[model samples]
Target: MTNKPAQATLLPDNIAALTAYSSAKSEKISGNTWLNANESPYTKEACIEIRALNRYPDPQPQVVIDAYSTYASVDSDQVIMTRGADEGIELLVRTYCEPAKDRISLFLPTYGMYKVTADTHNVQINSLSQDLLLNGEVKDIINAVSGSKLVFICNPNNPTGAVTSVEKIAELTKSLANKAIVVVDEAYIEFSESYSCALLIKDFDNLVVLRTLSKAFALAGLRTGFMLGAKNTLAPVRKVIAPYPVSTVVAQIAANALCSDAITQMRRQVVILNKAKATLIDWLEQSPAVSKILSGEGNFVTLQLKDKALLTLATNTGLIMRPFKLYNQDNWLRISIGNEQELKSVKDWLNAISAQV
Candidate 1:
């Protein structure tokens, strides 16, 4: 209340560096299979009730919470729903990260939103520079958060798509206690051969792991995402959250999917996509334009090029994939595993380009 200037918003001015997230609206993507978002190509097969959309979705839908909690094997009190996993990240930042004061950090080349959300809250992000596995960066992470409070790890991380081996993640969680909040984003754990950090939430109150239906449920338009954390950890975080973060249609469809025959169908699709991913890696490895493929435990794969110039050359044709320049991964491009036909489209186009090169 002294003589300080009036603040413009709750966030810091450096928050301006964060850009609005734009999904691909290009024509090339529409014509091909849609796989870039890690979404289930399958739509909600549930018979939509006309009344479902007419009424307001449960503000805290008990059924949806219970289902997600049970599916994740966590307590109902430990779950919180949001518009999407994207929204869940935002909620966590808003509730905990103090812009210009407290900071949030993550592994370089992991999820972009952790940094973006922190920036919006004016929370600085310190990232440790490490290659594929996060083995050597323990010291880097410790240094980044000299005065920070949160550290986020995108398991089966996006862009790079590698799951930090559980041994490494657990070590980081134990070591970071009292120093920072450890957020393990298991958005792609379904595709992994490993168990989810969800089962471990009770043991570490400092851990907050994220999961989404947008990928496996094939419900992108429905926009549903959730976070798992200890009840004590969520209490202060809950105070700053919105009242109606999730919609009715999303809850109904997602809840229905939890118990539906969707799991079996989903697993079948995974088997197909994993095979395609391996095929693409093999093909890309043979191409001179591609340098190497990064390991991801998620549904997608990221190919690192000798130079980003090759990626730029590919995108000008309207073939959209994620870019990693901001993360110092200028030579990397992330591609989601779509259906067989879509895979053919991407492969054929790249092969054609290979012939010309």
Candidate 2:
């Protein structure tokens, strides 16, 4: 390797933000049933034949759409299948958000990738202040980020796992009409009180609801996600996407996963996950060290602990929980709602820590 230093002027001005995204790390600790990334441990319905692999998959998988149509009850034309909702997020930015001419707005300590994607194109970002979540800073976001071309909301938001009302969303959509494209990310809505915002696509052309098979349907490994919007919103996205956006294998398995029986299975499992989540929430609430538990409607729960050092205690015990750094809430940690055993381990860790004090 050459030791010569590169010229300073050659360094791109915005490249630092472009390079900040880091992939979540994984550890293969034995008997450590994984739940760090909000993935279900069960297998999805599958019958993707190898023969189908000979042909390129549909750019927007019809089978996936039909399945999603029946599952989500939106028209097939309104859906655009993706690699995961993450891709849907990227597609929206590439389609509508021009680097210098446009801007993107987001409320945070939510999903990081939304900001990351915008930063990739040198898009201007309008982020909420630290107290934005508690206060009605959503009102401020709309007023302050005037002329923002795109707005993103992660319902039952990531990390916090709190939800905003559909009525409130509808009001925001109506206000931002033609002014901004509002994206409602429902990746975790399967476990929420709110239904998928896909239904709003019929009423508002400005709305784009991002959903994923990864969280609720246990299809994260398949890398399949979808976007629901009027055809107009997707037209520009189509222009920028690859011809074979989804693989044949993904389409077939996704189709199989969408069958009636599979839908029933997911609904049944939702009941199970809800119970597990409640159990963990009650256990967490009993601890004085745990001061706050955000209304955990998603497949995860975030807690605010008295001792910031307990974050290390949870991790060193072979649990890979995500400690939030976005807002510098050093005392907070997020734990995915795992199956019976996994939740028990979290409870046990908390119990041990409480005893030490």
Candidate 3:
């Protein structure tokens, strides 16, 4: 009898090497203040009527498609709802990129999901600095990502809150037309509405804009997101997507949230959060503990701490915030905009630390 090979050896090399995406703590932890995930502290009550628990939902629910398209000002055909923007990223990669052959491009220090998804599919990544796009070096960016299958741009960039101009994105899409699918992730667009690249989808067949209800709509639990582009651009993605991407209950709740009244309420909440973000910035600015305020947009504030010990201090005090290392800078920290009481707690902690100094 031939000797049996180890079970682990059956796993693909790429799968063996891949590191899973690190998500924020979902279970209850030993922290009173949770401000790590960049989630809205405000929760909107969703009234979902129970129905159709047995049958599978539509692959692309028309209600969600219509609602999101109407809100995004795109035709219904241009949208495909996914589990979240995360799934949209996966679908785009699976649809466009051939494992170990076709590659995707990403501007670093943006969303982690883009890289994670690319890696999971055994797709090669052409990593470029965020500065190339931020500085409007469109020609260089185009040249660097030449022949890539997809290029992802995260606007009002996560963890940094850096906003890339619409003009730069338009220039990129036009320059790389037919060469690569240019994906603009507007996950935080509602916080910086003027900088969205969604409108340019009509102009560029290669451009795909990703929008999520998790940030502004306060529906992270719903796991709903949309991809906006020319209908043809999204056609291939639909073929790769799961049979039933959105569940019946999630569809109803997301549809209701996309309504005009809910949108208005969402906008009002955004205004309030922006104001709270401003307050947090003011506090951070005054705190001697903060070395520099890196960014203040998209419902979170990122900063460089004067002392890295402050992170440990916050953790010991039951204050949980996100720690980041951008371009080898290890002192970076991100704080999500929580409610008034949460903000006050953060402020007090900063004050205490500053007083020690």
Candidate 4:
């Protein structure tokens, strides 16, 4: 008889209790329209020249660093590129939190990765209500997250598109100085540039802003992002990051995406998507199926449905949208702004549903 392999060991309690991040389905499921993941509706192609396949890429590609630094209005040393902002989150957690000892904090109805990464590192998570950050005073916010090592604030917050004032964020950083690192995840900032907390990095040593090319730059496939802060804040993270986090092709494409011309195109696309989102909001406002329009500031619109069954109807029509059960309600749905045709399909589906009611 053939010898059998030994049984696999059970996962640690921290990991055993966790669920994997539920990313939007990547496979084509008889639908050509995909607007679930907050990805840019437009695609800007880059003229890539592949060279040096045999050589390893720079851990932090200088070309990408220089271009992003100029674009973000930060010094070259202030930026450190990662596989994506997701990796940046992981790196920050790994570098700061001590397993089973230190904890990280975040306001809920925000990005899920903050808690997920902290959990993966075997670190405790302190989840405060979004109201604490949105409505609480700086001291109150500080008191709430007193023992945490890193605090993640997702401005133009995911799923909700609610933006916290830069002044409020700056105040929180100042109050929490030396107590914890305030990480502002600006994955959707390109859609709402004026509210960004990136400029506050120079003044606050404890503040770090996370950004990604995945959304606005329309380079999701490249998986490029940056962590911007004072060099000291990033030094520890650098020690823990992979030696070559960015692949050669990713660096070339991301560098191209950050070029002056590409940035202009991205701005133009943002304008277009903003208009599309406005139209979608208008439609949602008139729909009987939509109970409330929660937010539409970012690249997506979130609303509470009059009936949760509407989500099933949408999916049945080959329309995919992100579903949420936020603040004890299970009727919320987030629809990404897609191309004109895709938006039209959504509108038509909503109209048909409205007529039935």
Go through the candidates in order and give each one's C-alpha lDDT. 0.72, 0.78, 0.87, 0.87
* Candidate 2 wrong stretches, greater than 4 Å: 1-11, 26-31, 129-141, 193-195
Model 3 clashing residue pairs (backbone) = none
* Tens digit of per-residue lDDT, candidate 4, span 29-67: 555567788888787677766768789888889988999
Ranked candidates, highest lDDT first:
4, 3, 2, 1
User: Candidates sorted by TM-score, descending order?
Assistant: 3, 4, 2, 1
Candidate 4, overall lDDT? 0.87
Q: Any residue pairs clashing in model 1, and if so which?
A: 57-248, 99-122, 161-296
TM-scores for all predictions: 0.86, 0.91, 0.96, 0.96
How many backbone overlaps does candidate 3 show? Answer: 0
268 Cα displacement, candidate 1 (Å)? 2.3
TM-score of predicted structure 2: 0.91
TM-score of model 4 (CA atoms): 0.96
Q: Put down candidate 2 lDDT per residue, 1-357, tens digits, no spaces.
A: 755457545665676437565544443443354557787856754654787667776787776788897777688888888888988989899889887778988877778888888887778888864245335655765696578888888887887776777876777788888899989999998887355676778899999999998888888888888888888887788888878888888888888878898878988888898888888888988876787888557888888888878766666767677666635667777778787877777887888888765
User: Please, what are the lDDT tens digits per residue for candidate 1 over residues 1-357?
Assistant: 666556545545575456855554422343234545666555556676666577666787889889888878899999988777888788888888776788776667666677767767777777665462366676655665566687778877776776677767676777778777788777777787474777778788888988887776677777778888999988876777677766776677777878746667777777777787888778788877776777557778777766666654455554556655644557667788777767776786577667656
